[model samples]
Target: MKTTLATIALLVLVLGWTSEAIQVQENGLSFSLEAVKRLQEMFESRGTVQQNPRSRSSSSSMCEDPMLPQELLPLCKQRGASASLARLAMVPMDVCEICAFAACTGC
Candidate 1:
């Protein structure tokens, strides 16, 4: 039946996308860790004290911004690792999404 075939096709597409997401996550973890390592290296090279710049009043304000991921927010609060760095680390995954979208669009 057409419906059954369509259902099977959808299932196949779902499985494929899921696998792609898993692969992205695996790759993303390594990429994020490397980013953190590089940031640490840069800080050490600078010989500057690692202290978060945000004051108590600004801390709550920054938390409201959804541009930063919830999981990385805590790390961003730390002295060396910043929200910008965390955002930078996520760039690859964002690119992957764009590439995936382009592929889906037959571009």
Candidate 2:
């Protein structure tokens, strides 16, 4: 009985950690994308090329293009609409400074 209880506790702990890791990864990506957007806008306003400094310009362009990557093509074939929709839904949102501040403050 004790062993069973311990197993259950371990499973719960694993699940919690998985969830937290996913959340943190998502948040970090969101924050990064937001920073990119802001930088792009700033550059555009100054008549400079608006590009992500961290990412390869060619790769970014390819991702934005209508044609999907060959590697992702197979996944799309296997999962179809569900996988595509999930990917779309998980696309990172722009990070807000106010949100970041609040998160840091534990608000």
lDDT value, candidate 1, whole model: 0.41
User: Which regions of candidate 1 are displaced past 4 Å?
Assistant: 1-64, 77-79, 83-107
What is the per-residue lDDT of model 2 for residues 40-83, given as tens digits with 9 covering 90 to 100? 44334533342432333333343343444333333333423332
* Collision count of model 2: 0
Ten contiguous residues with the weakest lDDT in model 2: 22-31
lDDT, candidate 2, residue 68? 40
C-alpha RMSD of each candidate structure in angstroms? 11.5, 11.7
What are the per-residue Cα lDDT tens digits for candidate 1 across 1-107?
99999999999998776554422222123223333334434433433223443233333444455643455455545554444443333334344445462212111
Highest lDDT among the candidates is held by which one?
1
Per-model clash counts, in order, read 0, 0
TM-score for each prediction?
0.26, 0.25
lDDT measured at residue 80 in model 2 versus the true structure, 0 to 100: 39
